[model samples]
Target: MLDLVAVLLALGLLMYLAYRGVTLLILAPAMALLAALLTGGLPILGAYTQIFMTNTGAFIVSFFPLFMLGAIFGKLMDDTGSAKSLAGSVSAWLGPERAIVSVVLCCAVLTYGGVSAFVVAFAIIPVAAALFRAADIPKRLMPGALALGAFTFTMSALPGSPAIQNAIPMPFLGTTAFAAPGLGIITGLVMLLLGLAWLNRRAARARAAGEGYGAHADGVPGPDVAMREHAQGEGFDIAELSGDPAPGKPHRDGNLPPVALAVLPVVVVIVTNFAFIRIVIPMLDTAWLAEPLFGATTIESVRGVWAVIVALFFAILLLIAGNWRRLADLRASLDKGADASVLPIFNTASLVGFGAVIAALPVFDLISETVLGVGGGNPLMSVAVSVSVLSAMTGSASGGMSIALDSLGPTFVDLAHATGVSLDAMHRVTAVASGALDALPHNGAVITLLTVCKITHREAYGDIFIVACAIPMLALAVLIVLTNLLGSF
Candidate 1:
C-alpha cells in the first residue's frame, strides 16, 4: 500500500540524512512529518504534537535522571583523571605482550563503571596506542578491542550495567537493571571470549603479514571540529569532556590517582546499584505509587530507574569526595556533564517520537502485526528480530531500542505472559539485541571511533565488524538459546 511505501521512504531518508550528519533534533521530527504527509488524511499537526511530542516528552521525563547522573559520573571520572588512571594501570598491569586483552579490559572497566562509551574511547585510546606500539601489534585492531570491551559486553550483556541500553527495557518489562543476572553474565562472557578470539586471531595473522602499528603522520586525531559535531549530536561533547595532554599520548601515572582509589567509584556504581535493586527499593512504602497523581505506575515499573539513578548519584559523590583536591574545576565538570546528557536524551527521544508518529499510521498496524508474528509466537525471538532491525535502521542502540519498545513493548509483554516467557529473560534479550546491529558503518559511535583512531573504515572496519557486529550477534543468539533452556535463571 502507499502508506507502507511512505513509511519505508521516511525511514530510508532518516537513516541517510542521519548518516550524512544531519542532527536528529531536526531530522527526526521532519521525517515524522514527512511520513505523516505522505500517509494522506492524517492531521500532520496532531501527529507532531499529540503523538510525537507526547512520546518524546514522556521518554525524557522517565529517563532524564539516569542520563544526567550517568553523564556527570563519566565527566567526573574523566576530569579527576580517574578514567585515565584506571585505564593506564590496567594496560600496565596486563602489559603490551597481551596488548589486545589489556586494551579491552581497560575499556571494560571504565564502561562497566558507568563512564560513557565516548569517554571510554577517548580515555582508553592513549593507553591502547602506547601498548599496541610497544607490543608491535597492529594499530588497526585498536578499535575492535575497544569496541569489544566498551561497546559489546559491558554496555549491554553485563548484569547491573547502568548503560541506557540495559535500562531502557526496565519500565517496559517490569524488570530491574540486574534482570536475568545469570544469563547476563553468561552472554557477557561469550561476547568477551568470542570477540577476543577473533581479534587475537587477526593479530596473529597481522603479525605473520609483517604489519606493525603502521606509520601515521597524524597521531590520534584530536576531536577535531567535524568529529566533535558528530559526537556532540550523539551525546556528551567529548572534546569538552576531554582533558589536557591530548588523546594519543599516555598520561603520566604519577599525576594520576592510585589505581585502588581510581577504581573504587566504578565498583561503587555496580555494588550500590545491585543493593538498591535488591534491597532498598523493595522495602520502601510505595503503595502511593498506584495513585493517579503518580501515573498509577507500580513500584516495579520505576524501581530500575531509581536504582540506577541512586547508584550513579552515590558514585558521583564518591568520585568528588575521593578526588576533591584533584578536581581543578568542580563546577565546570558538573555543568558540562549535565549539559552533555541533554542532546543525547533529546536525540533518542526524538527517534522515539519519530517511531510514535509512524506507529500512529494505519500501516504500523500491519507492521506491528508482522513483527509480533515473527518466530511463530516466540516472544524472545520476535523481540530479538524487532529490536535488531530497528537498531540497524536507526544506527543507535538506545534510540532504536526506545522506538521498538515504545511501539511494541506492551504487545511483547503480553506475548511473554501468554507464552510463559520470563520478563527478565525478555529484558536481557531486548538489551542485547539493541547493541547487536547498531554498530553498522554509519553508526555515530563507529564513525567517531574510527575518526578518533585516525583509521579509515577501509583499513580497520573489517576487524571492528567482526568484534562489534558479528560477534555480539553470535552472543545474542547464544543468549536466546540459553534463555530458552534455562528460563531466566
Candidate 2:
C-alpha cells in the first residue's frame, strides 16, 4: 500500500512538474528515485544506472536515426521555401472563404510528408494568420486549425506518416506503418471531417457575433502586416516572409519555387515510404535479421522504421538538390536539424526510463493486472484504455505510448495472439489511442502550438480539445467497435 502511494505520488509530481515547465531529463530520475526509496530494499543508484539509463539509451539508439533524418527533412523544407510555397499555394487555391480548411490542409500535407510538427507549426502560422485575417475569421481559431491538421490525423491516423507516434508501435507489434490500412483511412477521415465541421461551425458562430480576427497583443505577425507597416512598401524580406532565414545573412531567392518542384519532395517521402514497405522490403532476403546481434528481429519488426528512414533520407537529398542555391548554409540547416531532435528524443527516453523503473517494482504488478483486466478479455479495449490514460498523464503522445508499450506491450501481444486478434489491428488501435487523450492542456505539443500562435489557452484550448482530443476519442471508440465486429484487415 505504501509502495502504491509512493508510485502514484511520483507520477502526479512528474506530471505537475512537467506542466510547470521543469525539464524531464532532471525530473524523471528524481521522481524514479523517490519512488524507489519508498518501495525500500532496492539499490536506488543501481536502478538509475541499470534500469533508467539503459532504457533511455536503448530508446535513443533505436530511434535516433529517424529523429535526425525527420528533423533534417523538415528543416530543409522550411529553409528552401518549399513549406511556404505549399502553404501559400494551398491557401490561395482554397481562397479566404475556405481559410479554416486551407490552413488545416496545408498543415496536414506538411506533417503527412514527414515535416516535424514543430516545424509545421512555425512554417504555417504566418500563412494561417494571414488567411484568417483575410477571411474575417477569429485569430483565436488559429491554434485549433493548426492542431486539427498537425495533431490529429497526420500525426497518428495517416497510413504513411513518419511521425514518431505512428512509428513507435511497429517493433512491439511486428507490424508495418501501413498497419490496418482500412481502419487507418476510416479513422483518419472521420477525425478530419468531424474536426472540419466543428471548426466551420465555430467560424459561423464568430461571424454571427460580428467578431473578426479580434485583436490580440501577441498575435503572430503576418508578412502582409509587416509590409503594410514598412514605409518603403519593399515587400517582405526573406526572413520576414518565410520565417526561415536568419537575419544578417546573405539573402537567397525569396520567390516561391514552382508548385510542382515545391511539392515533389513531400510526394517523394510518401510514395517512397509506401514502395519500400510494400515492394522493396518484401523482395529482400532477411534471414540474417534473425541473428542474436539483430535481436532475432524479422523484417516486419524493422520494416516500418526502415521505410521511414529511407523515405526521409531520399526526401532530404531531393530537398537539398533542388534548393541548393536557395539555402544560405546547408551545413547550418543540417546541424540545426540534428540539434532540434535531441530534446524531443531525450524527453521521451526519460519517460521510458521512468517507466522501466516503475515496472520493476512489485507494486507495478497490481497496477498492470488492473489495467490489463480492464478489457475483460478484449485486447483492443485493454490497449486503448491503458495507452490513452498514460498518454494523458504524460502530456506527450509519444512518451506516454512508449512508456505504456515498454511496460505492457509483451503482455498485450500475448493477449492478442491468444484471442486470435491481428497484430496489425493492435498496432493501429494503440497508435490512434495515444493521440486521443494525449492532447490534454498540458501536452507539450499543444502548449507549443498555443505559444507559437501567441494565443492564450482561454481563447483557443477549448477548440483544440474538441477537435484534437474529443474527436479523436470518438474515432478511437468507433475503431474499437469496428475492429471487434469486422475483425482486423
Among all candidates shown, the one with the greatest lDDT: 1
lDDT of 1 by residue, 1-489 (tens): 888999999999998888888889999999999999998736998998999999999999999999999989988888788998888888778777999999899999999989988888877887788889888888889889988988999999999999999999999888998999999999999999999999899999989998888775434465765467756643444544344343322223346778999999999999999999788886889999999999999988999999999999999999999888777678877897888889889989999999999888888998988887786889999899889999999999998899889999998999899999999999999999999999998888888898888888998999888888898899999999998887897
The TM-score of predicted model 1 comes to 0.96
CA deviation > 4 Å runs, candidate 2:
217-245, 248-253
Give RMSD to native, each candidate.
2.3, 5.1
Q: Candidate 1: misplaced stretches above 4 Å?
A: 218-220, 231-254
48: Cα error in model 1, Å: 0.6
**Pairs clashing within candidate 2:** none
What lDDT does candidate 1 reach at residue 120?
A: 88
* Most accurate candidate by TM-score: 1
